[model samples]
Target: MTPSARDVSGKPQGVRGFSGALWHVATRAPAELFSALEELPPLVVQVLHNRGHAGVECIREFFNEPVLPHDPFLMRDMDKAVSRISQAVRDGERVCIYGDYDVDGISATAMLIETAILLGIDVCSYIPDRVDEGYGLNTEAVEKIVKDGVTLIITADCGTTADEEVALAADAGIDVIVTDHHHADAVPSRATAVLNPNSPDSDYPFTGLSGVGVAYKFVQALAEEYPEKLPYPETFLDLVALGTIADVVPLRDENRGFVIDGLEVLRQGHRAGLRAIGAVAQRPIETVTSSDIGFGIAPRLNAAGRIAHAQLALDLLREESASQAEQQANELDALNTERRQLTEDAVSVARQEVGDDPVVVSVSEKFAPGVVGLAASRLSEEFGVPAFVGTLIDGVVRGSARSPEGFHLAQFLGRHAELFETWGGHARAAGFTLQPVNLPKLRAALVEESRALEGDVFLGPQLHADGRVFPGTISFETFQYLDQLAPWGEGHDQPRLVVENVCVQTARLVGANHLLLTFREVAADIRAIWFQSGQHQADMNPGVRVDVAFRLDLNVYRGETRLQMVVDDVRPSAGERSLKE
Candidate 1:
């Protein structure tokens, strides 16, 4: 899990530039063994082997549809959470589902609401305003729910760290069943029934369940108790995939099965709400992929949380009417665009202030609370360091921190817990708050922590090329074979193909910074383009021999399709095959 971009001035030998070659025969055996291995396709073997699948069985499982998940009752506290919620429903207690503002939170809320509805229970959702009310359950929101006669609260995606608020709700006679996936605290005495896979007391096999994953499990538990209330329990996997991918959970274990099977349901284009969202996002549901969920659908769903309230996304998910859902979806799309702009602007400003620090820490009183996480992630990307983006909210300084590969944000914050009012998050990303006066102490502590660590603060990027291949091996057939590995997400990435000592028959600039190249392989001639490669074009021109690292992709224009090599990196070759100028 190396950070992709960093200065590679004195990098160790053998590492390729994002697509560098590995496992060469010269470094292993003779040409006979190398040829034997090459016969198997290097790129395919490299990718498959990198992901711990060497045999045909593993490869088949990797590509094929995953198996069904075990029963929800397999979870530790599913029964307790479900029993409490069912009791509330039977007692006619007004229940409010409090959820987070992100896609995970929204989907979790929607899942709970739908499950409750199936049982003929009256359940409403409440998502805090990102700008005004901030994150998690708050006193104001609790008072309002209590006033509305809601005596039971089912929290989704949040409330793990809301110890005080959960106590307040209990004082007001509202019992809380927190069905969350966030990391558990040490004390762990907040909610009445805390059903989190990450909890220390839990024995769930896979702890990377998204917020929606926990919600689905809770609903499944209820479905078990009241079998007549719902049909088969696995029908809501489409929502599962949406939130799972949106939250960037590792697509492994139960999560892999959830998304792999869930994607089939999403692609069917049956759900009115999803259909409407697909329409607004302008993606054909029949052609939906994992990439579509992350790039097209999730952002719009998350937009409501960033700009206003996550309830909008929850409502859109639960909407029964096609027209109304479509309208809401369109609004979400607009809000997503606004969110993108805001995040980009914040990232630009934050990057300028990061300087050359190994650990980036910056604060902005004006940054939107919803977009800070994204901004911190982008800053981490640009600077190759863990980043913290903070904003002053209602006398409390709250922010999101995104960490690079080697850095553990949660552990780092935990070491400095005395400075924070509340702090909890995953290894890669986290959220926290402290007094505005404590900001300087936290920043100083982070710097000291990074300085005390040995060696590079950044993890060196390791480019695992799928396999080595001659330039002639790259063709339409090859591209199609590689594209078979679709629906790529976390735990699986697109394969990289490498070509060695190819003569740049011709090269020129196309659109602005794009570089188009006509290259000559041993027996094949092909045209390739590198997007945003003005500097590379100036460095290498016609007749220069070079090694090109790129990924295979299909390009379509006016319905005509052709295979293209998306250049990742190019370096001058020292071989004797240079074409004379």
Candidate 2:
């Protein structure tokens, strides 16, 4: 009997060494099941089942059914939060919305402020400078807000683990309501209410909400009470979608609904700032998709935080004037361009400093604290390891860490809690602050901890394909069927299909490092594009047979729409490999 392709843990351990990856092609659906679902294509069924939506009802709900928002009251401490906020509104107390300096944080801040404004409450927003204050709630900022006569501090996208800061605010006679999604060690007892789904006592069925998602939940609950004040709750879904997609949360359950509905809201061009941002990004707001948010809009919003302060982005979200919104959008676009260059330069330097260690840790004053996370994320992907990138600032080290699939960053950081001044984030991404004296100890501890894991755990990337498709099966109709599964991100990735034994008819270099190729798939000739593969031009000569992993893409040129293959990776055909050897 043959062993299964999956390991004991059921993770796919594919046949290694095809374009430096182990292709984990999913097994085909059972014939009986395929026959039973004859209304749908077999390929769609196979992809859906692979994504854990195997049941017919689950499939239907995922593709067709509407996912309504869950009751925000389901979250523990919601009533307390609402009650305190309501009192502030009633007494006309000064309230400050303190948020982090990321897109999620900014969107959450904007959403809450808009809600408060709609309810005729006195509200102001504060987003700490990323370079100066770092992430999460800070004591100095709290003290300043308190000094400004703020009687209540409503935190969005942050304050989950700010035990000391929350205590400071409480001492200053300021009520604090923490609305965040980051994992917390323990709910800050000092906070008036912690509205995080990741809290241990939380009963919310969908724990995958982003910080903006949580804020939207708060708005939903608040609207229920003050329907006269907050008339249209759905008006804020655009911000919810922006932050939810930008934060890279799982696009499942309620999150899927947020994005699906939010996309509709976004398309309406209701937000002038979003319209300006779309104009700057060269993306039409009416035709924007999830990819547009992830690649085009989110970066510009994040750039304000990364390169300067997040207040610019928060203001943009709240701005109504088209001219002012355009100016703000242009400023953010410029910052994003600068951020990209800084990240590339920092990643290059960090790569040189990183030795052949299981865990890569690079620290230097040269790296900007704001862009260190981007550098760390890139390094993690480049080196196939957990990466910790930090910058030494005023005798303290501020850092960000990004991990691969197997490693849990928050858990790993928690194990060494005493080493840092502060630390908190989700499982895959986290940030921390520590003294310079702990650098050596931290490096040694990480190296020792990483040694316990299997060597192959961080070995290269793994490409998961939805089984295999023959050249003849690739059709516009098939692509349209797959297109029904919209709003893909995080847990629900766009499908990658494998085509075996296709002959390359022609290859030419296009823009930058992109390779334009013509492939003969049986009797059909299809146009395919492989980005950043110009260096592999020699391997794709005419008459060369290769196996390609690609995604179906719709290309429209000169009023004609055609199906094209967006190649991900290519390898010599199985037969050709044997001949070469």
lDDT scores of the candidates, listed in order: 0.74, 0.85
Model 2, 160-214: lDDT tens digits are 8888899999999998999999887688888999999998788898999999999
lDDT of 1 by residue, 153-259 (tens): 98888887778888899888888888788885542365678878887777887788899998888877777788888776678888888889999988777787788
Q: In candidate 1, how many Å is residue 84 off? A: 1.6
* Model 2 regions more than 4 Å off: 1-19, 455-458, 522-526, 555-562
Question: CA shift at 518, candidate 2, in angstroms?
Answer: 2.3
Which 10 successive residues of model 1 have the least lDDT summed? 20-29
Q: Cα deviation of 139 in candidate 2 (Å)?
A: 1.3
Give the Cα-based TM-score of candidate 2 against the true structure: 0.93
Q: What is the C-alpha RMSD of each candidate to the true structure, in Å?
A: 5.4, 3.9
